[model samples]
Target: MKYEISGKKRFSAFSLYTLSFLSGVVMGLTVAPVGAWFLAWIALAPLWILIIKNEKLKIKNSGEKSSFLIALAWGIGYHGVALSWITGIHPMNWLGVPWWPSLAITLFCWAFVSLWGGIFVAVWATVMARVAQQQPWLRVLIGTAVWCGLESLWSAGPLWWSSLAYTQSPHNLVILHLGQISGPNTVTAAIAAINGLIAEAWINRQYRNKYLAIASGIFITCHLIGLLLYSRPIAQPPAAALKVGIIQGNIPNKIKLLPEGLRRALTGYTNGYLTLVDQGVNAVLTPEGALPFFQRDLMRTSLASAVQQKGVVVWIGAFGERGRSYTNSLFNVTGNGEITSRYDKAKLVPLGEYIPFENILGGIVQRLSPLDEHQVPGLPNQIFDTPFGRAIVGICYESAFPDVFRRQAANGGQFILSSSNDAHYSAAMPLQHHAQDIMRAIETDRWTARATNTGYSAFVNPHGKTLWISGYNTYETHAEIIYRRQTQTLYVRWGDWLTPILLGLSALGWGVNIFWQNDGNTELRS
Candidate 1:
């Protein structure tokens, strides 16, 4: 004799919660560091099943509340489990706050930040639970839409991280080629659609569902196309080449601004630039905030010596003050010792670069801050003209956003130079940041040279392959044959084309659901 529980009755309330959270944890592991990309293909299957397998009796009275709560739990699980490395930073304690209070503040801040992604997951889950009342096939398309839409909006906002597609970056060469077709959203949508089919198949306990077969077929077809694309040669007779020198100074953020630290940074940057110039680089680029002060302070004898060496343009990251506000900027010293072609950072790190609601909440956070933090944003799409070609400058965190590069490339940028200061972050953060650039490179078909003030400085090709990679805690310089790409991708020409279509499909499904609800047809039949 055997006993088996069925549907929602199979698991207790606590057991369901654990299952929901586990789904999210699996999803989180799909991203960088862990990079279990295969898990992303099935991560949401359990969550989808959790929503669909519930009885109408349970959903009717409290489905909205239940769905919202479950999604929030999933968000907490994914973000809380994945980004727990945030606690390692202990940003408040970095400000000299007491250990106890710092711990409290750190947890609170992490939860607050996690809510950004959590809210999107919550919305997606809520809609899926409601849509579960409808056709199973419709659930597949709408569910995919919901996830793609959420990632689309989130990537545009201040708290942007790698998109779900980014999990496969720099590794999954086959699926990663999808970025060349429709940006990262294509891969993310494909994953979501597959999971949706898997969920429906599981709900009816039919492993041989045609929907599952179709989804599988699509996945395999896309991979095959990706393989064909990957096998092709990347260096298709480049129009021009720009040899850039990337300087990585292994300096900690804590001492980087101190007198001795500033001296060391200046010395390290100058030496690196001069060495690369002697080796015949067209230009030399340093990491963000490599020079703590303004342009005048950087006009020292060492800098002059760098300028005097040759016509090699020296691009230094400095603080540019205009009236009361200041910008984290990049500029060049010409052969005539003239400063020109300046690009300021527009996208800022929400808390690190500048505090939000500073006037109202500034008092409370001031005690936790090590120093006054204020940096003004610059105008968008500032492409600097160099002898090699036009270059786009994405300072620090801004490099993570694809549109930042797209806009610059559209404005006629040929090559990409990203300057970052990531010393304050933990071990996993640099790799995460690098993954973003790899996607950007694939999308725009541009060569990317990322110079950071500690680690993860590398040269990436248009095929999203790492040409050269470096380690942390070392002063080093890299010179590579960087190609200038004037070619525009479909993604560059039409930005986020999938997002609105996905959102529209979700809206149509939601509208239909609303009609069914008003007509008292909770059970959607075809």
Candidate 2:
């Protein structure tokens, strides 16, 4: 039966818009720095309630649908405030960008992305509301499947930054364990289900108690699953544990271009790596492009000396040249005095490392960027041969892409190393970036080491626990033990099959239901 409230109460257009926008604001607070993960479970309840109660079309757009405008208001509140960190980059003084122009570019980029994403969110809400008009009980399932599938679809959202699962990151590892069972989308689905239940309880007085019970059950089941994952031992008996060291020169991005700055960086890293070796560490990791020069120049410098010394392996980040094209890559060198293996970052940061759709939007991007971003992206699923065993390396921006690590782990990488230069942005980025890397560790069940310039460098276990970490904006170095694993989790072996399948079925079910509704209407008239 269709779910309807006791009364057909009409909410004002202003009230509905307020409800959606306010809910979105709550949703935005669930991520890092403001890690109030609890809000994620019910953040969308108000918006969902608004959709269920209001059938009248109020908001209008001449060139667009009503749903787009409705979602845009919500998205402006959510993504606008959530992405405000980008506006804090201070590119005016650093990149020679004019003050007002920098603010304008940042605002436009934020608005465009937010509004673009709002279109999809609006569509999802509209469909869910339609489903509720028929089988109200199915709305929760539909919401779960749609949202989970949406998050798994890498191309669905702009910049691949709209992961619903990433919102509960770093703090909500309990709920986060669902990612291991069925990718991050499962976590997203579970959160959506909670909001759906909340909306159900609010609108349908007859089913209020039933809705509340179902919501509690779902919450308990998710957390219990999380408990089971967390309670389990992360590591089995390892064949061997490799002692790895990380060195952060803590060189600020602005000064790295100067010759004197490069000299200081070279001296600092050289001292740090050699010092780690002296401290009996077998391997030392450096930050992304830590040396700030070409491979030939690095080979001719003090860095090569550490590589020449027997039994010590230096996994350093640098630029790889292939006939004028350069790549942000991790180069593996050992006491053998030559490069053994290298992994170029396959997933480059959009605009930061390489411009997206450059052939089409080249001139527009040029005006925004400070550096010559002519970098070529590397091939996917690369695993490097290290002294310990196979290893996966993510250079800088690739930490955001979990598939990079998962594929390598499946290919028998014992551990993951993600080297980044978070110095380009403010202090907040490092923390958020570190949280993203933690998800990769949990996803792959590999001991992960992240070395970064201007900090949040951490040693993460298979369970995504931060075993050891360093402060931001400081020159720091430390060594830790990393384990070698031999088993594959279901997610690593099969990828995100469940999410896509669920979403596809939901869309099919909705289409079929709509066909029946129209057919019945004609039959009744006849």
Q: All candidates' TM-scores?
A: 0.91, 0.91
Error of 2 at 418 (Å): 1.1
Listed per candidate, the RMSD to the true structure in angstroms reads 3.6, 3.6
Worst lDDT run of 10 residues, candidate 2, spans 55-64
Clashing pairs in 1: none
Error at 253, model 1, angstroms: 0.9
Please write out the lDDT profile of model 1 over residues 1-526, one tens digit for every residue: 1111253354555676777888888888876678787887888888787776653436433466666766777777777655665665565443567878877877786787677667778898887767777777778888888788888778777877746787777688688777777788988888888888887787766654776787789789889977876777766455577788889988777677677787788788888888898888878888998888776677775766667766678788888876766789998777777786889898887766777898987787666666454677888757788667788778888876778888888888887888888777666778778888888888788888999998899998888899998887789998988888788877888877986887787678778877877677545543
Those runs of model 2 whose alpha carbons end farther than 4 Å from true positions after fitting are 1-12, 56-64, 129-132, 155-158, 236-238, 367-373, 504-526
Write one digit per residue (lDDT tens) for candidate 2, span 1-526.
1222225444455665666787888887877568677888888887676565544222232112434455667766777556556655556555667888877767776677677567667767666555556555667668778767555554432266646677878988887777777667777788888888988898787899999999999999999998788778865464667888999888887777678778878888888888888888879999998887777777877777756864588988888876677888888887777888988878776766777788998888777656664778787767799888888788776776667777888889888888999886656667778888888888777888999987989999888889999988889999998887876777788877777777777777778878999999999999
Highest lDDT, which number? 1
Best by TM-score: 1
- True-vs-predicted CA distance for residue 309, candidate 1, Å: 3.3
Q: Give the TM-score of candidate 1.
A: 0.91
